[model samples]
Target: MKIVYKTDTLPHVQQVSELFRSSGIKRPYDDLERLQRMLEHADVTITAWDGYQLVGLARAITDFSYCCYLSDLAVQKEYQQNGIGRNLIRHLRDLLGDEVSLLLISAPSAIDYYPKLDFERTEKAFIIPRQA
Candidate 1:
């Protein structure tokens, strides 16, 4: 198993969407190409692969200086509980270092998961949706 950074791996986007759906996360089926495009400017994207098969993914949007928002993260259901998620978080953190403000909106089920990755709830944090 190896975790590597890749941005143009859109062929694996269908697999990624399936993994998200299985993980109970809502995602557009046609968004694979959209995701591939988004990754073009992403600060970093880490993918866990088992010899060319993508099994997990973690991506973030950042200014490369002040702030970063973890956009999405998912591991194959069969690959869960094997520490892939933790490894993914660590990899992203190392890529960003401590200079950027890292943030993510975790699902209610992941309340415990994010903290395990050293993320904490902030009292002053809030978001106002932007026009689409």
Candidate 2:
């Protein structure tokens, strides 16, 4: 199964919502409008496809100069363990260049996964929980 990656395109919202649910990501799958807005506003999006199927995605908001917040990284369950997620981040980093700092708030289940991918764990971050 060959995967094609694209940076200039975004998969349909239904496809992305399905992938997020299937990949066990903590997102508001029931809120289609919110999901659509998420994709529309993200500054950078990298998607992985097998033929026409949306298999993986990495979505982020960035200024392209200082910092990048990787908001979502989801891969279809069947497509996991194949380095698709890693490669998606790699592509984002390549596009962002070395001057930008990449950051993400990991789901509780994925806390260990980031360090394995060379993402530094930080205790200095804070957030105001979403009120949705």
Candidate 3:
């Protein structure tokens, strides 16, 4: 049960895609090419791997100077509640380290989770299309 962290790895992309769907999150579905493109451009990514298997991932987009948006943060179903997500957030924060603003949108049920990671709720709104 070794949890290793890394960035820019392609193999984890599929696992993350599956996790997104299984977890009932809708973005990044059915487009591995686009997903790969997006991952390639991300400012930083923190992934937790159990041995060779990717069990969790946290991804961010940033200017590396002013702001960072942590868009997708997920721990595989089996790995949840084991502090993998917390580790990912802490590592990301340390990497950013007071040099940039990190922001993330959490699901209603998960709102309290980020505050423990030092994320404060801002008076900001996000818009998404229904696409139906």
Candidate 4:
């Protein structure tokens, strides 16, 4: 299973929506326009592709100086056990370098997973929930 990772390519809404659904990451996949805006606004997007298939993705909005909000991280259910998610995080880290710290609001299902990847857990975060 040769999965190639890229930072330059952005997958279509359908591809990302499909991946999100399959990965069980709840997002506005049914709202194609919202998904399109998300893709357009993200400063960093790394995708893992098995040939033409998008198996995993890491999308973030970063200032490239201090902190990065890792807005999304998802991998196809069938591709979960592999190192795709970790590799995707690694890719983000490598790109952001030593100066930036990555922060994400973990899905309930992914709470344990982040720590395994060396993500420090912090209770300091607060968010004004999005109602849409």
TM-score, each model? Answer: 0.80, 0.98, 0.82, 0.98
The models' CA-based lDDT, in order, is 0.74, 0.95, 0.78, 0.96
Give candidate 3 regions above 4 Å deviation.
8-12, 22-24, 126-132
Clashing residue pairs, backbone N/CA/C < 3 A, model 1: none
Please give, for residues 10-124, the per-residue lDDT of candidate 4 as tens digits: 9999999999999999998899899999999999999999999999999999999999999999999999989999999999999999999999999888899999999999989
Comparing 1 with 3 on lDDT, the higher-scoring candidate is 3
Better of 1 and 4 by TM-score: 4
Query: Where's the lowest-lDDT run of ten residues in candidate 2?
Result: 23-32
lDDT of 2: 0.95
Which pairs clash (backbone N, Cα, C closer than 3 Å) in model 3? Answer: none
State the TM-score for model 2: 0.98
What are the per-residue Cα lDDT tens digits for candidate 1 across 29-68?
A: 4577775676565667778776776777787888878888
Pairs with steric clashes in candidate 4? none
Which stretches in model 2 have alpha-carbon errors above 4 Å?
none
Indicate whether candidate 3 or candidate 4 has the larger lDDT: 4
lDDT of 1: 0.74
Candidate 3, 19-103: lDDT as tens digits: 6665555466578777787678777878888888778788899887888899888887777888888898888888887888888
- Which runs of model 4 end up more than 4 angstroms from their true locations? none
